[model samples]
Structure formats: C-alpha cells, structure tokens
Target: MSRVVLRRCIVRGRIQPARTSDVRAPGPRATAPNSRDGATPRHSASHDNRSRTEVPMVSSSVGGVKSPRFFYGWVIIACVWVANFVTVSINPLVFAFFLDSMSVDLDVKRSTLVWGITIRMISGGLFAPYLGRIVDRHGTRWPGAVAGLVVGLVLIGFAFTSNIWIMFGLFFISGLTGFSIFGGNMLTMVPPASWFVAKRGRALSIATSGQLFGTATFAIAAALLIEAFGWRWAWAIFGIVAIVGVVPPYALLMRRRPEDMGLLPDGATSLPVVEVTSAVASPTPTAPVASATHREEPDFTVAEAWRTPVLWANLAATTLLMVAISPFLLFRNHYWTTLGFSPTLIAIGVALDPFSFAIANIAMGFFAERVPIRFTGVIGGVWRGFGMLPLTLGMTWPGSVVLHNVVWGIGSGTTSVFQTMMIPDYFGRTNQGAIRGSITPIMVTVSALGAPLGGYLLDAGVSYIAFFWGIFLAVTVASASFFFQKPPKHAPAATDPPTRMPTST
Candidate 1:
C-alpha cells in the first residue's frame, strides 16, 4: 500500500490470489481517465479492472453455488420406517405368537383372548377419528410420542398381570394409546401424504416394508423367546424394545409436512397445476364439439367424499377383503398345525408371507406411480383370493402350502399399499387423516367379527376348509366388484368445469 501497489484482491466474483512479487504499481491508464472535468471516470476504472480479470461468475438461481444437500422428507420417511418397525414388532402382530402361552399360563380360553383382540379393534375404531383429527391439526409428533410411551407401559404391565379383566383393560388402553397395528398404520401413513406428492407411493411402500419385515422378525423372535424364556419375559422384552426404539425417533424427526421445513412437496420448487378439458355436445352433427378447460381437482371435503360413491365403494371393498383375510391370518398357526405339518415346516411357511410381502412392497414402490392404483388393488385382491384356495383343498400338499403363502403374501403386500395410497389419491391431502379415520370404524367393525367368527367355527367343530371356503367366496366377490369401479363424475355445473380424475396417487 505504501508503494501504491495492487496485491491479491477479489475480482469479478472470484478471488485473484496474486503473489507479493507479482504485485504491480498502477499505470497511468489505471490511475486516470480522460475526462473534460479533469477527474478519473468511475466507469473507465471499473472497465479497466474488469479487463484485467478473466474469471466468470457462476450463475445460480439464488446466487449460490448449490442448493441444500438433503431433503427433509427422507428424514421423515426414515423416522416413520423405524417407528413402524418397532411398534408393529411389539404389540398385536407379535401378540398372536404368544397367545397360546398367555392362554395356558393365565387359565384363559384362546377365544377369550381373541375377544380381547376384538376389543382392541373396537376401541381403535372408536378413537380413530379423534386421533386422526389430532394428527391433522397438531401433527403426528406429540400423539405418536405420548401414545407410544403409554402403549409401552401397558405392555410392561401386561407381563405381570394374570387377570383377564386386567388384560382386557390393557388391550383397551393399548388400542387407545396407539400400540395397535391400526395406530401404527395411521401414524406412519398420514405424515407421508403431506410430505410428498410425486413420491408418495414410494415413500409409503418403503415405510410399510418395515412393517412387513417386523412382522417376520418379531414373530420368529417371539417364538424363540417363549421357548427360551417364558411368555412373560418375552412380553416385557418387547415392551422395553418399543419404548427404547419408537418414541424418540418419531418425536425427534417427524414434522407435519414439508411446508413446515420450508420445502415443497416432493422437494419441488412449485406446485403442479393440471389442466382438463370438458367436452360440450354439438348442436349439429357436422359441427365441431365445443370444449372447456378447468384447473381444479376433486379435492372433496369429508362430507363431500362420503357422499361420493367412489369412497363408499372403496370402503366396502376394503372391508370385505379385510374380513376375509383377518381370520385366516389370526388363526394361521392353528390351521397349519391341524393340517399335520411339522412345526419347522409351519414356521418356514409362515415366514414366507412377510418375506414375500416385503419384496412385493419394494417392487410396488417403484411401479405404483405407473399403473392405475384401482387396477393394482383389484388384481392383488383377486390373486390373494386365488391363493386362499389351496387351504380349501386339504393341507396335505406341501407344494400347495408353499404356493399359498408366497402368492397370498405378495398379493396382500401390494393390496395394502394401494389401500393406503388410495385415500390420499381419491381425497386431497388436506383432510386425508380425518377422511380415513371416518371410514375406519366401519371397516374395523366388520374386521372385528372375523377372529371371533373363526374361533366359533373352530370350537363348533367346523373344519378350516369351511371357514376358508367362505373367505374365498367373499374375497372373490369383492375383488370382482372393483373391476367395475371408477371415479364418479361430478354433476353438470355452470361455474365449475368437469374434469377427468387422476388415475393414481
């Protein structure tokens, strides 16, 4: 500076790190510019400095080199995945594995225990709407955390209790407290609907895949635990795992939606606006048909969605399928044993369902956006119905046993994904939790009867064939009805323009 030399400087949006030896004194042209007023012109000096530097500025949308490194949506998905894996692994799903031990130790009938499940379903149905509304307004974090903690405490209490009344009370509390599979489903599914638009299907599939894996892992682990330790210790262990695993992740990582993180759905910078054209009939045969375009989707309110046939149809169809599958699933171990299969064979066959299911879920994540979700549902349901037919034929054939488990598991996995995705697809994300919650009571009411009905058949000396055949018929009819299903058209309107509905979620 004392020598009036130019050294290292920031020039043209880049750093020019000049060596000390390379520094040069300003020339006459750099120091001065020809001007009538006898002063250096500001534009001439700036132009001279610019001519000395050659680096170009990198253009960016926000004047930065790059955007943020991660999407918060994936963090939400990972949290949901962990929560679902832990919650599903501990209660209700793994409970079935320990049922026989619980029945023997507590001197309670298996049917009585089955009724406890029905109570769980009933309680869950009753509380679903209120809980869903809570999710809608407040977000899933508080409800998931608090309910998960309560469920864990109840499970730990379940380990020490021998009274059926106490057990019933615990089951009720667990249902209300979000330990049930129903609660896990609600918790895992609702937030993703708000977080993603384009990637919703993939996100749901990935999250639910954890449920499938948990089903397999926990069922096997329960069996091992019951054999090594007692069922009480096993229950206590599961309760501990749930508390340590599920609550913290959901509380720490879950936000209501991408908007809460200052991000758009699917990490998009802008929302997608779809345009549709309505056809108007011509006055003359030769005249060209008039067409009108519109910009809105059928984002129905809870009342409006309930009024639509599409919602009701989907509900009815889903209810029938659940009714068919629930009993078979609850009684699968007993059914397989009655068929004279060895315990090892039975275990292998049972494991196949969740493994196949997990694989199918992963596949659906990639392809769900491409196909019509309704068609996927119908096809999967039909395939599952077909898979159930092997049970109708006496279980003497191992080939049939293997076939049924693998095929039915795959179908069930895909259908479950569609069912979850369809709600947000048919209804907008704004009221998804509540809308699904409103329909849940009816579905669970029908499903609650399934286990009890199966138990009654078993107690009454009805063969597994009779119960399974009845299921096959119900599933067949329900799946068939879906073939005719379509989104209902909006009534002709003056101010609003009619549009074709989107095909997938």
Candidate 2:
C-alpha cells in the first residue's frame, strides 16, 4: 500500500510542471523599466485577460448620413453654429442698442462707452487659450452649456447695474461668454475632419454658414427687439431665448470624437471607427501615433504654426483690420450722438452690421473656393480703407453713414469671412486651436487700444474722415504683407468636388 501511494504521488508530480506560461500574455514593452531588484516579474493572472489595444474598423456610419441622419459631428456643427450666430449677433449689436440708456442711467460720458466694448475685447481674447485646452481634453458640450449660462446671467445682471464699474464688469464677462465658447468651433472641425476627408471643404463651408447666417439674422432681430422694448427688457429677452434654444441641441448633438465611439475617422471604406480614446484625446512625442480613421488629415503642431511666415503675415493683416473695425464697435455711442441719431436708430444700425456680415459670409463662402484667399484680403483692405470714412465725417450726414456701411458691411463681412479660412489654410490640420487662440490676444489688444484711440483722435480734433483714410492705407499694408510669405508646403489643398460628410448621429 505504501509503495502504491508513493507511485500515485510520483504520477501526480509527473502530470504538472513547476510553472506554466500562457501564450496570450503580451510581450514586454521595448522601453519598460526593469526594477532595481532585477528579478523577472511573476506575471499576474489578469495580465493576459485583456487584449492589448484595439483599432476599430468602420467606413460609413451604421446608417448613411441622410436628412434625418445627421452625423454626430454635423449635428454638433449645426447646434454650435446657431449658438455662434446668437453670440456674435447679440454682443456688438446689443451694445449699440443699450449705450444711450446706459449713458443716461449711469450718467457716464458716452464716448467712454467704448470702454465697455474695449474691456470685453480684452477679456475675451485673454480667456481664449485656457478655454481651448479644456476643450482639447474634455469636449464642447459642457463649455458651450456653461457659456450660455454665463451670457444669460451677465445679461440679466446688466438690467440692474447702476454703476459704470459694475456695468463694465458685466460687459467684460459677456465677452468671456462670447469668445470662450469659440472652442466649440475648433472642436467641430477636428471630429468632422475625422469623419469626412473627402468632403471637408463643403462641410466646413456649411458649418461656417451658421455663423454667417446667424450674425445677419440676429443683428436684424436684435435691432427689432431693442426698438420695441427698452434695453433692459432686451437683456431679459436674450437671456430667456438662449436658455430655451441652446441647451437641448448641445446635449443631444455634441460628442467628444468618433474615436470615442470605437469607430474610424472620416469613415474610410477600409478603416472603420477605431475609437478616439482618452489616449487619443492627446498623444505624446516619439510615438506620433494616429488612427487610420479621421486624424490622418494634414495637421500642424502649434510651434510649427507659429513659425510659419504666412501666419505672421496674416497676423499683420489682422492687426490693420482690427484697428479699422474697432472704431464702430468701440465708439458707436459717440458715432451716433455726433450724428444726432436717436438711441433707437443706433440700435437699429448696430443690428445691420452683423446682418450684413451674415449675408456677406454666405456669398463669400461660394467665392472661398473660387478666389484666392489673398485677393479677398486685398478687396477687404480697399473696402476697409474707405468703409468708415463717411461715418467719420459725423453722424449728421446719414447718407455718408449709409454709404460707409454699405462698403463697411461688405468689407467687414468679407474680411471676417476670409479670416475664418485662415485655420484650414495655413495651420492646415494640426494645432489650429492653439494657433488661432494665439492670435486673439494680439487682435484684441489692437481693438482695445483702437477704440480709445478713435475716441482720443476725435478728442484731439483730428478728422475721423482722415483717420478712415489712414486706416484704408493700413489695410493696404496688411494686404501687401501676404506677399512676403509663401504658402505652407503641405497645406491642405482645396478639394475638387469636396469631401463626403460624416453620417448624422
């Protein structure tokens, strides 16, 4: 019996080895650190359980993007687009509406009213970078929702401001609301770039239309509102309408990116939705990995974008334009009062500025592909050169004001719309947010100073009509600057038929 038991033990020992290994376990990483202790790790049981990393495959959305089937990205664009329209439309337009009331109620110098606009410009440009990084990490929906709340609350607060300082504070906050949410536009571009490589130009143009259309329509509507109700009530109306209109679409429509959905980008026929993971929310150097999906579009690094000569040239262009545009926005109260227009009519005119831009943007959208962007700049310069001349002469002559605006509106719209193309054109695909964000500060500062400068020039007994001519010359300098630089070597080319759009969510 003892011999038989020993034999059984011997048999059991033979059946099992000292250690076991599973083929499924991953091989060691090339760069993994070895412990100082220098013993090979005893593999954990769960180590082999999960797969390494997955690259999903998906070309088209589960359902093709039809009218009812807006791709998640497209939906986000539409929603953000409307919000953008309302934001820009209400900002400058509403200021023109409420200035006289604010002047009377607060008893401040109306020329100083540009101080409010100047403050907003400075604040908005400053906050852009911080907001941009958060979007890069998280997503657009939250930021947009938060911006709406801020805009609404500040607008409501405007109703009660008895002090100029308090009103100044609120207007600055309104700018934060306006420019901070621009991150949404960048967010939209990145994902759509992932989903629709073939039709990117058209998709971008469509997305851009919202901003254009909204500016015009919102301007007109804002004027009508200011006309019917006092500025106080206009604030209330703007706040209420934003909450009702904006909140829903953001929640339902916006997404982080297609990679989050485990799908390929741009829905290439061969590569499917691979997943925009937290890992992909960003990537580190050395690896330089990108998905076979949408991220393949030519992208630039922030450093590269800043280094480009064209970008610097464009910066020069933006500076001249900023100076030219600031006079109307910063000095609207002074502009109207000197002309003897009623506060009501000034409000009405403010509305026209954005409305004109909206129409101009749509028309310019067609020309974007057809014309060289450089030509647009030259045309805009010529218009800006002359756009404000009539208004500078004084508000007493409404015809000059109207004519100035006709050119002003067209030139302003053209210049702004053209500026919109800068991202895809020079920065290409990568780091556009950072590059664009970087420019805001310079632009805003020019605007900030330009406002007071306009007022100061008027105070100095300089003819604003002469100032307008100088501004036109500045535009010429800016337009000419574009010639100093060459196009980025790998800049994205305009597509022939345009790329296909991502499927609707």
Candidate 3:
C-alpha cells in the first residue's frame, strides 16, 4: 500500500495522529485517553459548532501531512494589515488636506461629503455580524482573501469615479465589502488559542497593538501624502497601496490553523492529546447568544449566538451609539469651525486624531487580551458619553471645540475598537464574514439618517449643544451590548468574567 500522509483528525476532542513514525511506538496510555498526555492546548478560543459534527477534520494534501494554515496564514494577516492601514488612513488624511478642495470641485456641500464618510462607516459596522457567520462555517482563508481583493478593487474603482453617486457607490463598496474583519477574529484569538496558556493575556495584547500601530503610522503618512498630491492622486496612490500591499502576503503566508500542518495546537506537547485536539477541533460561533454554545465555556453555536436578549441589547446599543460619531467625524471641519476656532487651532486639533485613536486602539487591544470583553463595550459607553464635554461646552468657551474634539475622539476611538474586537469574543470565529457583512446595510442607513439630521438641525438654527447632547446620550446608552449579552446553556457562566490574538491584518 502506498503510504498516506494524512494528519491526525480529532474524534470527540481526542487527537489520534496515525503517524508512521509514532503509530507503533506509543505505550498503551498514548493510544488511550491519557489525562497525563503531555500535549494539551494552551487556549481554546470560542467557536460555533451547532452544525458541526463532533470530529473536526482537516483533509490532507497529496504530500500526506495536513497543511498547517500558519505557513501561509501570516501572509494574509500581513496583507490585510497593510491594506487596512492604507484604507483607514484615507479617511482622516483626505479630510485634513483635501476636504475643502474636493467638496468645492465636486460641487457638493461639506455635509454631502459627510455622506461619503458615513456610508463607509455604516457599511463596515453594520455588516460585522454577517462576516462573523461566514468565518464560522467556511473557515478564514478564502473570506480574508476575497475581502482583500474586493476592497482593493473597490478602492481602485473609487479613484476614477467622477460622479458623486458613483463615488458614493464605490466608497460604500470599499466600506461594506471589507466587512470581513470579523472573519479575522481567528487572527485575534490565535494568540490565546494557540500560544502559551500562561501568557494568553500578554500574547493577545501584543498582537492587538498591530491595529493601533497600523492606524497611527498610516494616518500620519496620509496627512503628508494628501498635502503633496491632490486628493484624486492621493486616492489613486493609496488605493494601489491597499491592493498591491495586501494581496500577495495573504496568498502566500497566511493559514487557518496550526493543526492544518499536523502539529498540535501551539506545537506544544505539554497538554494531553485529547484535550489539545478537542480545543482545536471546535468551530467558532456566529449566531445569537442562545444558540452560540455547544455548552457553558463562553463558547456557542452560530445558530444561537445572537438570539439571546443580550444580542438585542448590545445590537441596539452598539448601533445607535456608533452611528452618532461618523457623521460628526465626516463633517468635523464644518461643525468645529462653527465654534469659531482659527484654522491653525483646528489644524492642531485635527492632528491630535491619529494620536488619540492610536492611544485608544492600543489600549483597547490590551484590554481585549486582558479585560473581560464585555467591559470593553461598557467602557466605550462611558468614554464616548463623557467625551462629548467639548461639543457641549465649545460654543460657550473660546476654543472649546478642541477640547470637545479631543474627548470625543478618544471616546470614539475606544468605542470603535471595542466593537471591532467584540465579534470574535461574542460570536467566536464561525461564519464571521457573513455575520459581520449582514450588518453593513444598517450602517449605511444610519449614515443616510445622520447626514440629513445634522444638516436639518443646522438649517433650523439648532445649536451644537443639541448635537453634543445627543451624541453623549447615545454613548451613555450604548453599553447595552455588554450589559445585556446572555450566554447559551453551554456557557460556563452568564457573567462577563470571561476574557480573551494577532498580526497586522
């Protein structure tokens, strides 16, 4: 018989690798369920398994060993990391240097341009749930690849769009299409899921730092790029960077898991074989809370992931609270200028954005790794609500817009990071793309609603006071995603005691 190169497949959480090397050498305990088996997993990130059978199998290649996703997986993470850095950078970059020129030449109101910004925000934010669902079912490789490709294309397409409607369509496409970040939850969880059991916190925190580093470095560069090139050229250049930068690494380096290569989780032999395999075998969740778990360990199935009362509460809270900020951000110049700060001061304040966001995102990343994921959302609520102090006071105090912007920026930064990170914590890694993507349209709706609402308020001679108050109010209430989330029957506890990944992507 030709020697086959299949890797071990788990049966009821036990990893029984029928290796040609070890198949005949093991003692009786090696073949049995040895509680003392020295190959336990370091950490097991939550996964949805409602439709998955007990065994989690990875098909072997012609060469025999199942391909470890890590060999090529890091490549995807690097690519997405660069692209996201470039894509996200475009927002603040364009606003700082090109907003006035673009607005005037396009013959649109500044608030209209706000539509472009908000459209993307809503698209990305709303679809987060759907994206999570996709990752849960299909695994992470293809979705990340596809989303990177489509985002690159959409951004490139955006450069040539001459019509406002076309711009809207393309930008919206970039935003909505890339809703696959939740699919990357596996990326976030890998540190905890695949590394030292003792160092899960530190590992996850370090990995999360990539987001802030990417955001900050790219954002600052975007400012300079916009200053040098016209906005159109900036778009073209940045789009190219996103596409060219992300696709190759993703194709060449990224993998879905260490198990794909026949190695045990974390490549460690310290854990029992059965425990290690079971930890790696379970699929991540992408559903309502009630259906999220196979049982009580903060893990759940996609079917029950979001259906719990917790989902509804957080859903409402997250959506409303998040919606308030983007419109304001899109029109920051106009809104803040009205408070009568000079251009220099506004410039100074706007420059603070990357720094504030960098700080907040970095902090949240560490928090995600160390803190209870639920508290991240709650923190967002408190931060954002209180951060609006500037908006409320700026009109009365000279140069108060800066203070307001500072507070709001920090709050927005924290809230954004918390929600962005929560998909993995809540839904696990199952069907992540679908779960995240489905919500994209709601963000669109919010953007559509926000633009006109802000405009109407201004046109009706309403004060910024109302606007700031409204923003703060939403933030105050937005903590519900955390407060209201409930676990399925299988979860270890309904409390938020649970906690939890990696790379630039």
Clashes of each: 0, 36, 95
- The lDDT values for all models are 0.66, 0.53, 0.49
Question: Per-residue lDDT for 350-451 in model 2, tens only?
Answer: 545555655665576556545455555566656665666665554466555455555666776666545666565544433555666677677676656776
Supply the TM-score for candidate 1: 0.78
Residue 34, candidate 3: C-alpha displacement in angstroms: 23
The better candidate by TM-score, 1 or 3, is 1
Ranked candidates (lDDT, high to low): 1, 2, 3
lDDT of 1: 0.66
Q: Best candidate, TM-score-wise?
A: 1
Weakest lDDT window of 10 consecutive positions for candidate 2 = 1-10
* lDDT winner between candidates 1 and 2: 1
Tell me how far the alpha carbon of residue 59 in candidate 1 is from the true structure, in angstroms, after superposition: 13
When sorted by TM-score, best at the front, the candidate numbers are 1, 2, 3
**Residues 1-505, model 1: lDDT tens digits:** 0111121111112222322333233454332111111222112222122112212223232422222357787888888777777666444446677778888988977777888778777788778888778888888997888877887887788889989899889888877754444522577789887777557778888887777777777777777888899888887887887787778987887899765665556654422222222233323212111111101223556886798787888888878876766667778777777667765676667767878987887787657666556666777787687678788876577667678889988888877767777777656677888888888888887777877887888888887788888888888888777765554443323443333354322
Which tens-of-lDDT digit does each residue in 1-505 have in candidate 3? 1111212222222233333232122222121121111211112223433211122233344333433434333433344455455445445333444567677778987667666656665565555556545544444556656666777677567567678999888766766554323222332333233322222223343444444455545544555665677566666666676666556655555565545554433333212221111122224422111111111112344455555565556556656754665446555566666666565566556656646755675567556544555665677667666667766655555456556556655665665555654443445433334544444455445544665567666657777677777766766766655654532233333453322111121
